[model samples]
Target: MKLFGSYTSPFVRHCRIALLEGQAQGTLECEFIETDIVSSGKLSPTKKVPFLTDTLYDEKNKAEEVELTDSASILMYIREQSGLTFFSSANDYNLFCNVNTVLDAAVNLFFLELKDNILPTEGSYLERHSERVLSALQYFNQQEYPTQAPFSDGELRLACFLDWGLFRKRINIDGLDNLQALLKAARSYDIFAQTAPPEGA
Candidate 1:
């Protein structure tokens, strides 16, 4: 199996973290391929990072290769291959969706800010993107988690999004207690540390 993406992308970081955990569990064996997604079309139809190609053995013992393009699909395939469904319930799935929404907003704002050469101002699509990011963070702040909740895919994606947002200067997460706590907790894991985005990437 091989995963293609850049180091700075939060979506890619999420998959890298999964690969670490899955490897520790003895269920994953993948090679990481860092490349320019915008210029790389041979692997991804979207021309984006977080693409995965897996060679699975079929019931007839034949090698069959499959490709997964989006981060969500790639993560789902990882869970399936590792036999580790990190989402425990519908609530987990909802949280995963919420985090992905924030990720989308952050990416959009990042691009628009670069294109316009200014921070997202009021009454603009970029401003709306900023609003969505903050609202999602605030909502996540109020989320209740069981004490000592084991790290799961939802948490993994959330941590990656928050950290990447801060790293890229996409949004502010001030005073979001729950999110801060979760981020701190996630960083304690060796897998999270191992998958940290490259400096200046």
Candidate 2:
């Protein structure tokens, strides 16, 4: 199996963390192909990083290749391939999706500002997304964080998103105490460090 993404993608980071944490590293024979948005455009319909491809053999020994176009789908494929579950409970899965929601909003806003020189203009779609980002952060501040190693998917995803948002200067997550604590704990682990984006990103 192969995973393609950039060094700085939070979505990709979560998948990496899940593989390491689940001890699926050697089992999957996984290869990570570093890619950027421009390159991804030709490889995926979404033109996004973190797509995956794998070769499989059917009962008839027919070889087939498959492509997963998004991180969430890739994650589920990883889980199935690894025989591991990232979510400990339904609530955890819900939390993971919520983090995706806010992170997506922030990323969209960041790109709008970057490529279009647009801000969250009053009553606009971007404006509503801005509100969603702020509201999600405020509520997530009070969430129950993962306390130790082998953190759940939601916990790892949240930490990656927070760090990315900070790195991109897209949002300030300071004062989100619970989330901050989770990030601090995750940072102590070598897997997290190993998956970190390169310096100056």
Candidate 3:
């Protein structure tokens, strides 16, 4: 399997963490492909990172190809192929959806400010986005993520997105007490520490 996207992307990071947590090395080898939106133009279709390609033997006993665009799909593919329990129950799935919703909104706000160069100078709309960002952060902060055991996909994805937001200085999440605690707890994980986005991003 080849994973295409930059390390700075939270979506890509989620896929990477899922791969590692699932222990699907032999069946799914990850190859990180760094791409620039302006130059590569590959991210235009989905306008997102962390697309995946899987190679496997087909019924004809020949190597077949499969392509997955969304991070959710890619994560599921890895879990099913590896037979790992990344999302074990209804609660787990619900939490995963919640975290992903925040991630989506956060990323949209980020692009609205940075990519499209539409940073709100002054207006009620600016306040709306800001509120959304904080609400998402606060929601994550309230969750009780298990610190002693390996993190679930939901936790891993949320942590990566929060850290990226901080690294890019996209939003001021400092005032959110719960988010700060979640970030601190997530830092204790070796995977997060090692896979942090490149500095000065």
Candidate 4:
């Protein structure tokens, strides 16, 4: 199997964390290809990183290639194959989707400022993205988790976004107690530390 993406991308980071966990569990073997936007764009129809490919064998022992075009799909495939479904309930799934939205808003705003040279102004898409990011963070802050709750996929994904947002200087997570706690807890894991983007990258 091959997982193609950049180290700094929150979307790809979450997938890397999961895939690395799978490897530790003896459930998966994959090549994580560190890639860039210009190169990965040519590899996928969507012109994006975090694309994945795997070989599947049937009862007849026939080989076939399976392509997953997005992070969610790739994560799902890994979880299914590994029997490590990190989502335990409807709420977990909802949180996963919500975190995905915040990641989208945060990354878009990051690039719009750093790469696109389009600063956020009142009522612009950039401004709206900022609004979406803060609203989602506040919503996550208002939620509660049980003591020592399992650091599952939803929380893991959220941690990726929080770390990336901070690293990129994209968003302020002030007063978001729940999110702060989760990110802190997730960072304690060896896998989280291992998959983090290269220092000074």
For model 2, residues 58-77, the per-residue Cα lDDT tens digits are: 99999999899888898888
lDDT of 3 by residue, 5-89 (tens): 7878888888777777666344556676776666235553675677878788978889978889888888898877777765877
Question: Residue 200 in candidate 3 has what lDDT?
Answer: 72
User: Which candidate number maximizes TM-score?
Assistant: 4
Collision count for each candidate, in order: 0, 0, 0, 0
How much does candidate 3 score in TM-score? 0.84
For candidate 2, the TM-score is 0.91
The order by descending TM-score is 4, 2, 1, 3
Q: RMSD in angstroms, all models?
A: 2.0, 1.8, 2.6, 1.6
Higher-lDDT candidate of 1 and 4: 4
Q: What TM-score does each of the candidates earn?
A: 0.90, 0.91, 0.84, 0.93
Ranked candidates (lDDT, high to low): 2, 4, 1, 3
Scored against the true structure, residue 88 in model 3 reaches a CA lDDT of 76
> How many clashes show up in model 4?
0
Which 10 consecutive residues of model 3 have the lowest summed lDDT? 36-45
Return whichever of 1 and 3 wins on lDDT: 1
lDDT of 2: 0.83
